[model samples]
Target: MKTLLLSLKDVEQALSMEEVISAVEQGYISYNEGKVQQPDIVSMEMPENNGETDIKSCYNKLNESISVKIASGFYDNGKNNELPTMIGTILLFDGRNGAPLCIMDGSLITGIRTGAAGAISSKLLARKDSKVVAVFGAGGQARMQIYALCQVMNIQEIRVYSEYTEELPKYKEYVERNTKVKVIICDTPEQAMKDADIAISTTPSKKYLVDKSLVKPGTHIVAVGADMAGKNEWDPEIFKGAKIVNDSIAQCISRGETRNAIISGIIKESDIYAEIGELLLGNKPLRESDDEITIFDTTGMGIQDNVTAAQVYEIAKKKGLGKYFEFI
Candidate 1:
């Protein structure tokens, strides 16, 4: 069997934010319609190594292939070794005969799909008139989150917050150079979140960074950093008397932002309003009113990886983008 090897550059060439957002939305729809077979995320934590790796896989009935993605984050890599903090890979196989189709770099895919998921959630949950956006991290994911939101909303101002004071200026320059959106660097998380129509937390913080006092009533929060148990971005009290939705209930309850809330008994499992899939399938409403606080917890999903990897493979194959060789 022949297998294609796609590099990070090749993956970047094959995928676009506009195309990815639509594909991700359809992935959610597929999950809602019971057309995807996905398993819970399996993870290994190595505190000694200052890193963690997660494995997720899925099979979409409408697609001809199945995919498994392995992603890792070594937080100290940037400071210790001058390497990127995160890296990932994806393997796609033919579903029928289980032929190895391709192995591709998944770092960009992971970030883009995550950003796309936020965009999808924002469209379905955020108020139609939402314009201002606050991003709580000055990293790649934060940049992509803003870019993805711009595709679906008319964003006029962007507020960025980061504990790394030096990184914030660089991030602001990057945003200004790439997009027309007005970028502002805030000194504190509360300053960044104030009066924001939409807020996204992309920092990897073990403790809560956003408090309920700073969040406005009509704001929509996209909690992205808490993809593992014991990781969180906001206080459990934020979920009190608010609408909560998850990308996957089982995954979110165990790993996402809701994990802390659930474990603390601040919120019950039955308190979940609905899944994003249900919203896409029209089984549940998006936002009940403009005054309601809505939060979407995304723990990352195998099905997202599956659909995204499949799309990249097809595009690369058609464009003759990646290196192909016999692997089996």
Candidate 2:
């Protein structure tokens, strides 16, 4: 019995924001160097419940990330207090032997990794002295995005916004308590973005939550909500004024949120300055001036999951956190 396994708690305990950011940067660099392998996401639309729907993202990447997410949303808020409106798990495998390694909680991994991607983007794109951070959608990812920003930036105050009125106070209390950063729940996304150096979006709506006019001269925006096809968070003017950086051009065009901009005559695919890899590898510039606006469309690629999961697995194995079993 190759008796060592890892759980979600184990992975969470072993990983830090800085570590996650480093791994995400490495994943980006790997792509730029042509050393990483990725595939288009294959998914299925699950049947509905009380007129609500869910989706399953099935992915495989060199045995490191072989998992599916079953995510559903039900908005009968007044009725049963719908659970999270999202739920999923990960099934990690031994890439070398094609054997089971661990079945861990993917929620925190997904949340932290997503937030770390935002942090990395902000680090590369935003003004270094940025102090005011605006976050649209006061939800799970919003919490982490701001947390990472607080960890990395000089943010003295955080402004938050969400469409759901009921969740604002809860989000407000939680952020200020955990981050120890003064938090303000703004009434609108536009209000939140005003004079802010960085803005992050974490909603799944099919519309734009940010305004091009609200952002000042030098602002970095990390759009993480629209990771799928047909979802958008900004107009072309936002990308037009900023250096548009993508996680991956092909995926962004085919299914990511950037696809909408490309399709709507708002932006040309050629307008993209570079992928995150180019910056991570010193092949391209990230931030040039104090007045430049930068946009990062973070439709996550597979390599992120592969590398992060691999890191968690390695650390957990050394720490002896879980039990290994024979599942060949």
Candidate 3:
């Protein structure tokens, strides 16, 4: 049989933010319904190089496909190597026979899928009139988050706070060139989040960046950085008495921001309001009022990669977008 090889550009041509958002939403529903088998993530850290790598896999019964992804983040790559900080590859297999079907670059898919998750959470949990967004990073994922969010919310302004001040102007320029939203570079996390309706953190900091006191009522927070143990962005205290939603309770508790909260005794596993799937399936209530604070903790899921990669592969096949080679 022939296995297709897709490059990053090939995968990009096959995906749209709106379609990815829809696919991620369905992935969540399938997960909640027990239609997906996602294993625990395997992670390795290279502290000396300031890098981490993760392996995630999932089998989706609904899509009848399997995806295994190896993604790595080298924090100093940009500064020292002049390369992207995040890089990855995805392997897709036929669920019926376990035959490899496609191999594709995973960097773009990872960013967009993650961005889609943030957008989906905001659509389901944030207030409808939310116009201002506070973003806590200025990397590719942060840009992807803003791009995906623009598809769902009528955002007027984006307040950005990043430790890398040199990147702010470039980030702002990119956003303004692509969208109509005005971007404001903030001096502090508080300045960025003050009165913002939605806040998203996309950094890889080991320390919590947003304190509980800085978060106001009626704000929807998306915690995007803490996909592994010891990586945190939101203070545990922010989770207290807040409506918390997770992409996967088990995964989140083990590695996501939810882990920090539970470990700190600020919240319990029972305190989790709902998984995103539960909210989508109407098993639990969404934001009940505009005054309620809500948070979505996502540790990244293999089902997300599976469903998205499945779609991308199909599209690549139909369009003859990638090369094929025989593999026995």
Candidate 4:
């Protein structure tokens, strides 16, 4: 048997947000149907070095494929080493016989599929006429989140907030060039969040950035930053009155935004409305009314990584984009 080795450029050329969203949605469906075997994420944190790594894996029974991903984030890498803050790799294997299939870059897959998770949440939870967007981050994930949302919703105006004020215009220009959505730079995070139909937070801030007071009723907040313990973005108080949907109830309670809320006594485990997978399976209802405030807390599921990487691997193979090596 031969294993394929794919590069970052190859993965990027083979995958798109639209296709990833579709693939990820199926992952959620399979998860809800009890067809995916996913374990708790393994986390390694180094506070002294300002770095962390997470190992995730899952077996998709429906597709008979498995993927294991290792992703790392070193916040000071850009300042100290001029490297990207996040890096990752994925290994794809055949579930039927445990044969190695592909080894590929996972950073691009992570960003795109994380964005796809947000898009899936918005499609099911956001109001039907949602047009204006408030995005709190100017990084790669932020761009991809907006890209995925635009694929599913009719986003017209976008308000972006970033600590790096100068990067906002360049990001704005990039978005305008790639998408028809108009982008505005906000002086404050509050300025970006006010009266917005949808808000996405993609930063890795230790402290809460979005205040509960700034969020209006009917707003759908996609909290994507709080994927690890001690990483949070939204105020826990927001959960007191909002309907909370997390990617995984267990994952969220331990490391997602819901963890902070639960720790602060603002909410409890029973307060959770349902997992996004449950909503996808029609086991729970979506936003009951346009006036309801809904929050989707995504911690990035292993099943998502497995299915998305599988899709990318297949596409790259069919396109003859990567190198193949025989080992067994």
Better structure of 1 and 3 per TM-score: 3
- Which has the greatest TM-score? 3
> What are the models' TM-scores?
0.98, 0.88, 0.99, 0.97
Q: lDDT for every model? A: 0.91, 0.73, 0.94, 0.92
What TM-score does candidate 3 get on C-alpha atoms? 0.99
Q: Rank the candidates by lDDT, best first.
A: 3, 4, 1, 2
Name the lDDT of candidate 1.
0.91
In candidate 2, residue 41 scores what lDDT? 63
Tell me the tens digit of each residue's lDDT in model 3 across 198-315.
Answer: 9999999999899888988999999999999999999899999999999999999999999999999998899999999998998988899988999999999999999999999998
lDDT of 4 by residue, 206-251 (tens): 9999888999889999999899889889999999989999999999
In candidate 1, position 192 carries an lDDT of 94
lDDT of 2 by residue, 164-245 (tens): 8777898889988988888888887777887788888888777777766787788888888877776677765677757888
Query: Which residue ranges in model 1 land beyond 4 Å of their true spot?
Result: none
TM-score ranking from best to worst? 3, 1, 4, 2
CA RMSD, predictions in order: 1.0, 3.1, 0.8, 1.2
RMSD of 4: 1.2
